[model samples]
Target: MTALNWKLVVDTRDAQTLADFWAAALEYEVEDATPLIDHLLKAGDLPEAAVAEHNGHRVFRGYAAVRHPEDPYDPFTGIGKGRRLLFQDVPEPKTVKNRLHIDIHAEPDGLETLVSRLESLGATRVNEVDKGPAGHWWVMRDPEGNEFCVA
Candidate 1:
């Protein structure tokens, strides 16, 4: 058997916005790809049209990512080598329930507080659901309407 690397890839209308949201939500760090972007552009491997300025630094227009704060990353490429979420631009909007969603676990008695914090960050509370012994959870959506749960 072979081990494999993985990271969640999400579709978004605004990569930077989504990356920022998730980075804060998960206490992750937004990967800084400015140096790589500059190098690539200078080498003519990445065209000027494929990049944009975000927070005073260059980033790939179609993609951005966040990494777990403790994870290792390639300093030159700003690529995360551990837990990560990559956001890529898509022309269409999200119009349906997500087949896959993230579940955020709160510390004991922390659910309400966490929910409020997420709301302040542009997340909407969809509803709360109770499943008997299985416990209760809140269904929420990110700014771009990606579904996730908090319990």
Candidate 2:
């Protein structure tokens, strides 16, 4: 059997804003799909309504993505080949706890600082958990209410 590749897809009301927040939180780069957009626009293959300006570049209007800086990507589409998160615009608001979530491991002795930084970047602290000798972590919600953990 061969290994599979995948990226995490998130639903958000504002894809660009969520993507920006996640990019900063993860120290990742927002995928730049301008080249592909430009090519498609020139070829009359893409509609203007499907494009939007983000960070001063053209991107797919209801979609945004971030990828680890070291990951390989296609220059034409700026789609990452590894470790990516794609956000898509949705009509409904998040109404319940996440079924699956991300766990961020902080550098040794850096938990508080990491948490603070994430808060400044728009994550809300939900609660802190302490399991003596087992583990400790904080439950956090991204701006869109998606739950994640920091440890």
Candidate 3:
């Protein structure tokens, strides 16, 4: 049997904004991939219309990436973390609840700070979920409606 690597790639209306939110929330870096864009442009492989600057990084007119600061990265492609959240541009808004979502744990005395911080960055609390034993978690959404938990 063989095993393969995995990551979550999300479709979003605003990729760069979502990327920034996640980068701050996870203490991750917004990977600067402008070199790839430049290379592709020089090679005539991608159109100028397909590239743009977003959040100070050269992003795909449709995509951007954020990953944990301490997360392990693939030396070859620069992909990071055992887990990563990628934002790609999409035409439509999110229309359904996420079937799967990311879980976040806050350091001691950090939950309130984190929540306020994320909210300021445009994440809003959807509800407080008190599942058995877990007590409570703030079900929150990114500026674009992708849901995640903050505990």
Which candidate ranks first by TM-score, i.e. highest?
2
Q: Please give the CA lDDT of all the candidate structures.
A: 0.94, 0.96, 0.81
Instruction: Please tell me which predicted candidate would have the highest lDDT against the true structure.
Output: 2
**What CA root-mean-square deviation does each model show from the true structure?**
1.1, 0.7, 2.4
Clashes of 3: 1
Residue-level error in angstroms, candidate 3, position 32: 1.1
List model 3 lDDT by residue over 32-60, tens digit each: 77777787888999999998887565677
- Sort by lDDT, top down from the best: 2, 1, 3
lDDT, candidate 2, at 69: 98
**Candidate 1 residue-wise lDDT, 15-86, digit = tens:** 999999999898899999999998999999998999999988798997999999898899999999999999
Candidates in order, TM-scores: namely 0.96, 0.98, 0.85
Number of colliding residue pairs in model 1 = 0
Error of 2 at 44 (Å): 1.0
Q: Please identify which of the two predictions, 1 or 3, would achieve the higher TM-score against the true structure.
A: 1
lDDT of 3 at 136: 67
Tens-digit per-residue lDDT, 51-109, candidate 2? 98988999899999999999899988999999999999999889989999999999998
lDDT-superior candidate, 2 or 3: 2
